[model samples]
Target: MYVLIPAYEPDMRMIALIESLKETNPQPGIIIVDDGSGACYEELFQTASRMGCIVLTHETNRGKGCALKTGFSYLKGIGASGEVVCADSDGQHLPKDIMRVGSCVEPDSRSMVLGGRRFSGKVPLRSRFGNSATRFVYARSTGVKIHDTQTGLRGYSTDMLDFLLEVPGERFEYEMNVLLTAAKYGYAIKEITIDTVYLNNNESSHFRPIADSASVYLPFLKFSGSSLISGAVDFVLVLLLHSLSSSLILAVWGVRCISALLNYTLNRNVVFFKESGIRHRTAFPRYALLAVLIACLNYLLLFLLYKKAGIPLPLAKILTEIPLFLLSYWSQKSFIFTLLNPNG
Candidate 1:
C-alpha cells in the first residue's frame, strides 16, 4: 500500500505525520505531491524524501485534485498494485486510521473506504457548518447518507485508477464528485469512524470558503438551479392555464409539455451533460418518453390530491410535485440521461 499526501504550503505538522508513519511495522510506501509549495517548504519535502517517500513536485500550484491525479498517474506508471490512501497534510489523519482505510483495498474489489470523523468536540464553526450542509445536500441528491462528506482521508484500490483519472474536478469538488458517482461506476462505499482532530480550529487549511465551497457544491447547485428555473415557468403556466380553462387536467397537461421541454433542455446540456454518452443525440427520445410518463403520473397525483384529499388546486399541484420531483430526478439520471455502459 502507498500513502499519497497532497501538500501546498505545508508546515511541520506534515513532517510529524510522516515521522509517525515511519515508526509503523512493514511501513507503507509514501508518495507526496508537492503542489508548488515553493522554496521555504522544500525542507519539509526534502525531509520527507530522506525518510524514503517518493516526492513529486509541481512547478506551479495545481489544485488538490490535479495533485492527486498526478500521484495516481505516478502509481500507474510504476505498476503499483496496492491501495492508495489519500490523507491531508494538515496532520488530521492518524497513521493507524490511514492503515485501517488502506487495509480495505483488495486486488479485485471495487470498494472505496472513508475515514469518517464525528465532530463531537469543540469544532470550528465553518468546518461544522460546511459538513452539515454538504451532508444534507449529498443525502438529498444521492439518497445516500454519508456522515462526513468533507473528509480528506480516503482509500482507493488500484483498479479504480482509470476511472479516477477520468472523473472531473480540479479542486475539492473532485472528492465529492467521486462519491457522487462512485456507485454509478459500481463501487461500494465503506466508512469507518476516526479521530476528529482540528488543530487551531483548522487554521492551517488552504480551503477558501467562498470560492472552494462553490466548486464543492456545484453538482447539487446546478441541478437545483435548473429545477428552480423550470419550476418557476411551470408555476406561472399552471396558474394561468387553470384560470383560463377551469379544467385541472387541461392545465396540468398543457403546462407539463412546456415546462418539461425547458427542463429537459437545461438538464441535457447543463446538468447531466458530463455523464458518459450524454453529449450525443440519444437522450432526447428517452427523455421525451419519460416526460410523457411523468405527465400521466403528474395528472393522476393532482387528481387524487385535489379530488379525494379535499386540497385546493394550487395546493394539490404543489403537493403532487414533491413526489414527482424525486421520480424525475431518478429517472433522468438512471435511464434518460445516463451512459449506456454499465461498467463504464
Candidate 2:
C-alpha cells in the first residue's frame, strides 16, 4: 500500500506521523505532498524525506484536492499498483487506523474503503455540525447514506487513479464529488469504524467552513434550485393555461413541455455540469423520453388527485409533484447525466 498525505503549512506533528507510520509492521510506501508550506517548513519535510517518505512539493499552495491528485499522478507515473490510502497530515488520523484502511483495500473488489469516524468525544462544534449537515444533504442528494462524508482517511486500489483524477473539484468539494460520483456510478463504498481523535477541537484543520461547505453542497443546491424553478414555471403555466382553456390534458402537456425543456437545459448546463463526453444526441433523447414518461405520470396522478381523490386543484398539483420531484432528480442523475463507466 502507498500512503498519500497532503500537507500545507504543517508542523512537526506531520513528521511524527510519518515516523509512526514507518514503525508499522510491513510499512507502506509514504508520499507526502508539500502544498506550498514554504521555506519555513522545509526542515520538517526534509525530516520526512529522510524517514523514507517521497515528498512532492508545490511552489504555491494548491488545495487539498489538488495535492491529492498530485500524489496520485506521481504514483501512476511510477507505475505503482496496489492500495493507495489517503490520510490527513494534521495528526487527526491514527497510524493504526491508516493501516486498517490500507488493509481493507481489496484488489478484486472495486470499492473505496473509508475510515469512518463517529464524532463521539468532545468534538468541535463546527466539525460536528458541518459533518451532520453534509451527511444529511449527501444522503438525500445521492440516496446513499455515508456517515462520514468528510473523512480524509480513505483507501482505494490504484485502478481508481484515473477516475479520481477526472473527478472535479479542487478543494474540499473534491472529496464530496468523489463520493457523489461513486454513488452515481454504483461503486460500493465500505466504511470501517475508526477511533475519533480531535486535537484542540480540530483547530489544526485548514478547512474553511463557509467556503468549503458551499463548494461541497453547491451541486445538490443547484439541482434543487433548478427543480424549484422548473416546478414554479410548470405550476404557473398549468394554472393559467388550465383556467383559460378548461382542459386539464392540454394544460398538463403544455406546461410540462415548456418546463421540461427548461429543466433539461438547466440540469445540463448548470446542475450536473461537467465535460461528460456525452453529447446531446445521446442525452437529450433519453431525457426527453423520461420527460414524456414523467408528464404522462404527472397527468395521470394530477387527474386522479384532483378529480377522484377530491383534493383541491392547487393541493393536488403540489401533491402530484412531491413524488415526481424525487423521481426526476434521481432519474437525471442516475440515467441522464451519469458516467459511462461508474465503476472506474
Identify the runs in model 1 with alpha carbons over 4 angstroms from their true place: 235-255, 276-280, 342-344
Candidate 1: global Cα-lDDT?
Answer: 0.85
Candidate 2 residue lDDT tens string, 293-341: 8878988999999999899999998899888878887778777876567
Q: What tens-digit string does per-residue lDDT give for candidate 1 at 1-344?
A: 89999999999998889888888635788999999989989999999999889999999998999999999999999988978899999988998899888887666677889999999989998888888887876776667889999899999989888878878887887888888778555688888999999899899988766677786567557767888999899889999999999998899878978988899888888887777366546788888888888878888988888998889998998888877787777677767788756445
Give me the displacement of residue 238 in model 2, in angstroms. Answer: 3.2
Model 2 gets an lDDT of 0.88
* Shift of residue 264 alpha carbon in model 1, Å: 1.2
Model 1: lDDT of residue 100: 86
Model 1 clashing residue pairs (backbone) = none
Task: Count clashing residue pairs per candidate.
Answer: 0, 0
TM-score per candidate, chains pooled: 0.90, 0.91
